[model samples]
Target: MDYRYKVVDLFSGAGGLSLGFLQTKKYDIKVAFENSPYMQETYKKNHTGVEVQGDVCAADYADIVRRYGKIDVVIGGPPCQGFSNANRQKNHAISQNNKLVKQYLRAILELQPKAFVMENVSMLKSEVHRFYMEKGDEEIVKRCNIPVKDTFLHLLDGAFLFDGAIDIVKDENLINQYLWPEADYFELNVIYKSAKNISKMINALDHHKKKLESLIETYTNLKGDDHIAEEARKAFSAIKAYYDGTLPADEIKSKIEPSVMIQRMLSKAQEIFQNNIIVDEYVQGSDLAAKIRSFAVYDYLKDILTAPENNYVIYSDVLCAADYGAPQKRMRFVVIGIKRDISEKIALPKGSYDADEYRTVKDAIGDLEDIKPVYTLAEDKQGIVLPKAENLSELASTLRDSPVLHNHIVTKTTDTALERFRALKPGQNFHCLDDSLKTNTYTDAKRTQNTIYQRLKYDEPSGTVVNVRKSMWIHPEHDRAISIREAARLQTFPDSFVFYGSKDKQYQQVGNAVPPIMAKAIAKKLAKILSKKRNADAKKNCTKGNGRQSHKRNSQHKHVAYPQH
Candidate 1:
């Protein structure tokens, strides 16, 4: 069976969301809309399967309808300039009519896909709520008869929307026309029992289990009597009984006896096991991680509420990228929406690695040859590296003249500075520089000159990459700033992904581009979901005796791994 759905990506920046969606292999990317030529080139190179359109605002909705017929899914992050925290500090006002964000919403309305994924900074949530409050209040005042103010009506409407139970306006005319009007509002009440309680119970159980294990370990280490193990088990049982509310707290405490000693042991056990607990596996940095997780939860609720209709079922599974042999600590939110009337949830395939075979940075980029630094003599007698070779250079170079050239160049480093550089590893920072080497450059300057620069350590994960031009990213070994390639590698872009633009633009794109591995993992999850949906659709068609021929495809496609050179 050909289990695939079509996807349209809007405001597609270097194809992060598009890449994630493609990972599932179940969705065919039909079109991608982006504005920047540099980003368009990068997106085109990575996503040859999709039609990359320029400037989404300039693209006609009729053209999209004409080409795709009907998009199954729409996924994109609208430009977040308004919602960015940095912008918030600059007294810049966010116009509600930002054509870019509005254009994205317009596409969603036009396409009317089965589902659409909108990602933006967490701040957008507040913006949305605020808009709803203002517009919804005005709408209620114009429409509702309740003497209560517009805010109350808006709240009532929201409550009804969430509860999926409309009160049916007593007015016959309104009920007949507006209330339950042609299923415009789908029933979406999904009861969500907090997972927190269950998770807490599990933590309590594990905590006691660990306590017993520690006692066992201590007894074994001391060659004490085996009876101590039994004692530990009994103590754990008492705690469990207390946790389950089967025994009174005072009774459990009395039964355990010597409360002080028990507390001491528990504290010791907690200390011993503190580092072992994996509190949260999800890596920070990706802007959409939390939203995706929240959406998964929301979808689950949506499914439960609409279960009676048996129209849609949302299938969810937790998948960690590390398990799939991804070299980084990448966790993803995966959701599969299936038509409940047609098929069951699809089972996720097992990941490719065991604990012992976890992928690492070495596996991702060890083979790439390191570029040696080349220095050229400056007119002032000091030396600096030519940013690019003469013949290949196509763009104006932006590398600034070195401030060190203003002073007499010191060929020989002081013993302390040499020791500091020697002590610096690939990712070491200025903090590692010895006090003697810590120069007094700031002494002659203002407060703004107090910023310190650090060296990048080659062997470790790079610090969070950004578009700033501070010299903080200098080489750990060499005094020069890190090359653009190194920054891209740090961001986990693949070696094959070539950026085309000015040096600064290249930096912005690299810093902004989603790590391909992260994108791949997200795509894989999305692909799994789309596959499930397509399978459901196929089953429905088969039952109706209107089946299409199967499209047997190759099992393997060329895959790109991360730590781009």
Candidate 2:
């Protein structure tokens, strides 16, 4: 049975997503749209025989439609820098990168694909960082209602009342117990409930205060009737004191009008579906009138996806790479859209491993040939000898078996920085540095991320791997940052797939790649649905008793995996 379906990958960085679909032998990858000359070379070289389009932005849709008719799938993660939280610049909204998402959307609309897959830095779902979608962005902001203030803020506000008390009580540990950010406030049961109660109190108090303020605005404080002025003055003072915390909770109960609290929540709900961050997983967004404009996509799609209730759209929880036996804890967000004619719902395969069974950093990179971690700042490892591979774990074996290594090069680090790496324990980052070693002006040691300059724990899945050229990601057993091959291994790139370019470009290619193992699973699920539909059509044709044979399958559709150089 031929299950081949044609696909076009936009923003096809190094063809990682294409590689995933290729592995299933169920896809006929027709075109990959990438603009970078170096990345284009990598995709064309690794995904041999697939057509690599130079830049979709410049390509004419009419010509593309004429050249390749009936493109089954359009898939891409548009340039994420526009939506990325890491881009702290206020002008991120106007970055040319932000406009690239529309380019991706344009491809989908033009191709009219049966389905599409978009991979993005999970922040696309948030309102925190704002981006201009089009010319009339101001109108988008004007239409948004002031979101009832976040209750989680109220929880922290309420719980904060105890921070000083706990400090005085000499129980600093208690603060950690109650203030733990183990999950978003939306998911934390008590935190959300507490915030809900506080929200209602704030709303009621604000409403009354606004009313009294309006009356005072119309009638000068002296012009108001004496009793009326005295009553309004007392109400305002009582509400203000309640916020100041001097009036106490019981006193606020008397001072503020109590409204029905927790209207947003229902009784005995099994699941509290919340707009948690873009999971896969991570990130959130913010602001009042301006912030709500970012949810234009969410509000527009949400009603259509949910109101039909025909199971046409399925909202799956975030997919964690560790759960799928990947050697890293990389998380990602995914959404699937099926054309009405194909299937009603998509079934995600259950995760193959639990947290305890997650593949580890050791499981991924342990058997690689080792190189001495010491290197001068200008050292280029063109002839560095590598140690023999030993102690191969079963998982590591699947990633590589060849004795010859490629891209086994590390960045140059200073002797002083090496000493700092030595000081950090496994999984402890710059935050754990001693005062003498810490940057002089860096007062907030706690603000340091645990993964920065931290050694990977041997038995745990590594966190998201980024370009470590200037980063402080230390090798688990060594003082230096991980080599390119090691980073690729952690990203699950097979040994045969060698990246071509300068070391910087190679690292960028690896850092930007989607984990192949994770992508394959998604491809397999989509393949099953497409295959079933094709089979059903064939059977129906047979039942019609046509004397003619079914359309012959194309011989060229048979694909060969990429050949080694």
Candidate 3:
């Protein structure tokens, strides 16, 4: 069989991966998947003849296969905000956003591509969120009464469970009757609010005999509105007495089983103190591990993605873009799968350069130093063309792939802001400002990192160049923020690969892309491996065909003497 090595890019942002793979001149990128209108237009503009689609979930793979035959490889970077370290509040709902990863998996399963490469934020590989998750789960569970058997409850007229005790049993219809939400026994409330029904209370369920006896004694001395506590005491005592007496096994089993209250604090050797609990112990008490483990889809895919049988291998690791020669320091979790039946174990190329020899901000934008930029005229919101360059480094030359640059236009600023920029040195940030110049952007004026209004350091590698329109990343030498063209340069987008959108949208597209240069190196290496496999497969087919021909010739001449005859 012959091979063409076609590729499908999922979650394709701004065509960075496509550009890199094109640079390899190996596989043909037949289709790209990007939902953003601006990014879609930009990709279409740069890489013509490729089909672009929106919505990965709604993608019609059968149609794609007809247009472009069996896709050999699938590559892309899914949205990472759900697992990004920068997100302080991580939860089941937030992590649910990672369903995009599962969607990527769906493409692989449906297409059964020969190989796949995926990237996400690095924090996905870390367990740091466990501590916070466990804490949150424990608190939530406490507020929600966990049953001894984990069974949900049936309400008076509808479906409801764990409508536990009120945090405070309130005023009632009568003096003796305690008030609960909705009065009919199930509160018209949310999950968090449902826990107020007292049944979930830890004190209510813990050491029933002793807690009730103590409470009973206290209740004897209590005055007005002590009826709720009295009723709790009587219930606990009755349950304890019922357990004390022997009942038939079936009878006991049929009846409600006793469940102790859930405890937030834990115990160690001969010690019991909530105040003494440590971080490690606190985290262990949570179901956070279970929740997080549940959010992950790889384990579920293992059964579906059988190795040796499926002819491919799927695995992942947290990779640094810096390792791939990206000018900025970026860490992303990369998931790679190689179809062994099509090729050998796919080893991603080792980085050519290390930190000490990292590509710097200067290497990325050195040639544009002399060029001054003007603000947009609102009609041409896309920046002015950068002047022709001179004395470009090898890295710069690659980044400036085309002679014409599209986003060289600068944003306009006031005199005061320019004056503040004059005070900021290359490595120094807003902190370097004098007391008079230091505005109270922060209440304490000391609560943030130096990066808030920091300028790029010329010699050092740049920080992650995010959407600068919002963050307003200052230029190293210039008074204003770095221009869109400059930001793209830092991102290793070739000069010719112009972005098609409003200035803000263009900046976002540039910021979101994988460094094309780094992506190119990866593409180049993977292409080599695939190319090697294709050649080997072709050679095997040739030998097999020759063998068949030889056999046919031998069969025709049944014996050697027959030919002579």
Candidate 4:
């Protein structure tokens, strides 16, 4: 039997990254961790013989070694929704999703895998993406020499809100310090209100639950208000779970903190409008600390991972999925790390295709153009017969390899959606629609992204495949939404791989996945590096006297090929 490197996948959503490593035929994915039950089902079914665990936060590295033996590689793209550019409400607090990046690092530090790969949103490379210094991070921050800065929280908005107050100031630059007083008071007031509100909610759980239930019941009997009903139902369910003591402690905190923080911020801002003069003395006191010292996430990662104790050679760069032959222009920041003892060098995977050779929408899903998708969830396996074509694109051929297709289901559309879908031409979006057609769709129709209500152009690659079902992404030539399978194909997922969940969950799984084609390129590169290291170790073992190995495996290497990108 050929030697297959053992692999462990963290945050293994829908097994897209693992699928890529599997495609290399050089990796044996022994275990995976995914928190979502739907994703866990899909991953378990697809990646047979792999142990699927839940909640990477609660994972025990020692137990894993005892059961699965030594792991060779660790690969995963932790949740990056917190780092997405679309998130407008960036704040000083590190989001729970953002904290998963540190958990990925924890896996590396504990498992001490020969090589590890991590991927996240391209925005992570920006200097603006950082972590606020917590009390625990102070010692590490100082020891790592990571640069820290004092950022005035919740003051950026005050710059505009207090523009009138600013014009009266003699020095234009003094406006920031002048407004700092108001910002500090604003933050303190919000904090106070939030804490009070949380206590009230916890104390009056029955009252709030009854209120949410009443609102949900009222909306259930109404028409043209499904979205509002859904929101209410979600809230009621959460409150019910919390009251029943079924919700996790972290979930309870997460549910309460964000909503309380945002609501209190807005309500307090209005209550304290122009009332800062009375509290100016309080703001200047030690209680109101407006300036928060923080360090960049990228700098911290570099400093900690490259430290002498970790002994890892790490490389990071932004990689485009289209550059790796996927029909989507999705860009992600990728980090590859190799044990320094295994090799003193490390490099990121180079893209094989440039702009001209990028795959198009037609190349990806053109074969499925004639097949009508089911309007609702049906059987797990559906028969798919492709139309006869003389020249099938390589991507399309790979996508059609399965004997049967699954997830070829589209969300049923309303008349308004069908109208908007028909009105859009190839490459057109919601902005091109008439004002009447845009009603009740978004909070701000003008601010709606062009990606929403988009009609795919056959000749061009699609943009990042977000939850296209929510976007209402239309077909290129047909007057319907793109099916789940089409979106998967655009993400370079072969038809043989089936998604197991509701239509919405299936779409989310596809959107959240790292394109297998891009993942395969990365896995192949790592395989070569590991294989070469193994060969070098074997050679050194022979050279040692009496054929005795001096040290444990992966501990002997002093030099190896690690070409820079």
Candidate 5:
């Protein structure tokens, strides 16, 4: 009990997870790695004794061991925004964000911590969330039984490049007669020819600059071409004229401007560009389809960590933060791995609180309701005084540990935002607002999530706390955004633990944090398993030295060995 286990936190954001383990009083966070400058400042300010490294990708695990001795536990929540179901971008395959998961696993592989915990979005369990197969991943992909199929790799909006089979329609009349009218087809033909001619002229003139310059200089005197808009034709001619000192520099801008007709043509060209599809090969799939390579992220993680060489027995499950007393229903995928040599048993922590017993918004932040929040990051040396309220809830009382309060900052609301905020009731969001109030807001307001502009209900736990400031989370009763401190309270951070950064960044730090209450439960469970192993090892060593222990006593506490793949 006197010994404190050494731990290293990777992708540590504002030291939330680290704080939870530190609260158990059984672990010492020796080192932490965070990439954001603001997050680094916040982490360093809170975790003063721990060394803070920059990027998790640049972390050298062997060097970490050499400097801090053996790291008993490794814990981190690698960035999972790319894996989020809400992401609508085209960079889903092999994005830079997804690689950090591998970096986290690399730490366990090199540092070989007795126990390591990885937390990420619950969507990580989905089959759609996958990483593109890289070189040397074929064997592992097949071994994991991960489903793989050929999919067109998107290059841009509605544009894709596939290295697989494809069919091309050869009937020209099918497009000209059925797809578009005669006028539309003629306009497209003119645009295509004009663009082709312009490109050919530009390339042919490259080697005959003097003649091209002379021709361009006299173009203003020539009759306008019927094939393209005058503006489009002038733009091509003005380019050489401007460089040859024939056209006034100031006039070049006006001459090169595209007319409405040309603009329409350019818009059509953009659609064509977006519709463009390219593939490396056109062969159809068969038994040869086995050559099409790709792998799901979770499959690869399980394959590598559970291998005999890695010596880990890992268990993964979706855990709700509310189950651990946080006033938010944030669900995260948690993976806990123990060194197989340390113990064959894999025990994840069971929730201590059920649905009826879960903490609510009022229990977490009801006390700070009337207090006016500041709109800036400047700290008051005297610190804002908190009002004394009687019979504060346990969660609220635990959060009011600091004598002075900080980070009670809110975003300045506009009149438009204020009107929308006032219209919402507890448990209502943007969707509840009147149609007149929703105008000119989101690009597509109807498709907006229910979480946007959410007003928390006093009796219920809040939804996942994203950047409340960005989401403009309305206060339960007040017609204003929830303060950064309020959001942090929902995540179970004590008042004394201050966040350092811009107001927006501070809100982001809070949103991205693992609820400390949940983290503490996991940490406590790990500590118990690790402590049991340590005691068992100690008893065996003593028994060997003395040669006095009976075989029956040893057999009663024998470690069970499980089969590893």
Candidate 6:
């Protein structure tokens, strides 16, 4: 009646996902499983009450089930090697046969919680290689048997339904043989022939279809193998059909026409796809809107159709840390699953600040009086230390040859260079480097003024913080690279969230982590949903009897122990 749920986090690296869900207030993370000792230690340090287990694969899921009767949600990201685009490029077979992905799937099947949220890089949607390899002479022969226009429509329709929904018919032969049989084709031909304008669109569609077919053939012959040829052939043919007006007229009129609504949808879709941080690779399609909508809708159906009444709701624009008041730009994919039997509309949390009132780097860490730069030789030595004044004997003596010291030789600035350094502000890049002092690195041979590194300004947001040391993230004014704390602050990591490992490891963790603010935002939404469900359950039970009312009050009391704020 109190509407509280327990969560089990798998692959809980630094408890980012766990933090997000806990922030939601509706669920309490009872136990979390992380394989890395470093990560586990960090998780334990930050989360005092929750149990942190090691090695999810080694840990007994059955034992967990026994300990925590029924887990309301199982949330975490599996190591997405198999579905990654990089893996696919290296070895398609190996990538496709990724054991970890299958293991993750097995875990989900075994756990059978009310619902689960699986997040991964977008490369999982890469065009299946088998689809491309089969686009050869055999496909051409198949197209010749069916009217090209009908074939195009069938393919698009199939893609829309299959990739866009969970209820896709798995048997390819059944789909090919029964769904779009020859009779259906003749029916479509008759309809096309009867309508004049529709016939014109059909003709245009046919022309593009033929052209695509030819291209597929050419590509296939050049490769001298049928592998992936069919897929390539089909994918191109589908695109041609959509663009050339061969797709169903009704669908086009309703959704694809260049109307204001369609335009806005397209624009939004483009923005979503473009800004998607997880998947940065090639996508072959004219309309990104169609693809994103298809995927989102498909995921919704997959999660919702057979789910319990209150188990799931579709959420979007779930901001990562940078989107809220955090100075760092960490974005992530968020999908929440709530039990439907509970009556509640799970609303997302309001942002901590308005867009104009966002927090900056200075606001996050400027008050930390000890602002000395330190590096690390060993993984364990990484941490924030206090800085000392320039002329102090103790300060100069402490600057030894450990990896934890900032060792940039202070530049003796000429009048011109000094003026340039003074003039440059935070967030400004090497472009502000004085013309006279510029030199080019080998990597920037073709570019002008390439060998310039600048210090960060206090007021502005830091550039993308990456693990690679010789890239864009140099200090704006200082000759040295930005300190670990500086990088963490930029990423909106709270001063309290300590990172473990050496300097390099710290950088990697900071760079790789989901911004805390982003995690907090997602958590807020989850909390609101849980609260609503709890109140609704309380009301429902009150009608049943006074006994149930007592249970509801007890649950509410338990919830108060873990304050939402």
* Candidate 3 lDDT, 1-565, residue by residue in tens: 4344699999998998888888777778999999999999999999998899999989888888987788988989876443322231111123334557667867887888877777667765443212112223344223333211121111111111122222111112231233322221111111112123333322233434353444434434434544343443443344344345643222321122111111000001001111121122211121211112212334333334544446676566665666787778877666667776765566666777888998888988878887776567363455445567677788887777664557776678767667777888887776788877766244345655666667888888888778876665788877888888888888888778778787788889888888777778777777777778778888999999999999988987787767787
Candidate 5 lDDT, 1-565, residue by residue in tens: 4689999999998988999999999999999999999999999998888999998888888888898899999999886544222342221223467778889978988998898999999988776666655555567667756666563332212122122212111222321222323343233233232332444333333544554445454444445453233444576566566566686544544454333233332333232223332223323332111122445678778888887778789999999999999999999999999999888978679998999998999999998887788877665445688867888999999999987789998888999999999899999999999999987566467888999999999999999999999898989999999999999999999999898888899999999999999999999999998988998999989988666456655665563323331
Candidate 2 vs 4: which has more TM-score: 4
What is the alpha-carbon lDDT for the whole of candidate 1?
0.44
Candidate 6 per-residue C-alpha lDDT over 130-244 given as tens digits, one digit per residue, 9 for 90 to 100? 1111123234324323211110101112222223211112223322322222332232233233233554545544554545444444433433233123333343344445656
In model 2, the clashing pairs are 127-286, 128-285, 128-286, 280-331, 280-332, 281-331, 281-332
Error of 5 at 336 (Å): 0.4
Shift of residue 104 alpha carbon in model 6, Å: 5.4
For model 6, what is the C-alpha lDDT against the true structure? 0.47
- Clashes within 3 Å, all models in order: 10, 7, 9, 0, 0, 41
Which of 2 and 6 is ahead in lDDT? 2
Off by over 4 Å in 5: 81-93, 139-149, 155-292, 379-382, 548-565
Clashes of 3: 9
Model 2 poorest ten-residue lDDT run:
263-272
Q: Which ten residues in a row have the lowest lDDT in candidate 3?
A: 261-270
Error of 5 at 422 (Å): 1.1
Cα lDDT of all candidates, in order? 0.44, 0.59, 0.60, 0.73, 0.73, 0.47
Cand. 4 TM to true fold: 0.75
Residues 373-471, candidate 2: write the lDDT tens digits.
323322433434445566778787788755556677776777778888889877887777887776532325456566667777787888888886655
Give the alpha carbon lDDT tens digit for every residue of 322-439 in model 4: 9999999999999899989888898978899989999999999888888888876764455455556657899888778776767888988899899999899999999999988987
Per the 3 Å backbone cut-off, how many clashing residue pairs does candidate 4 have? Answer: 0
- Model 3 gets an lDDT of 0.60
TM-score, cand. 1:
0.47
Cα deviation of 431, candidate 6, in Å: 7.3
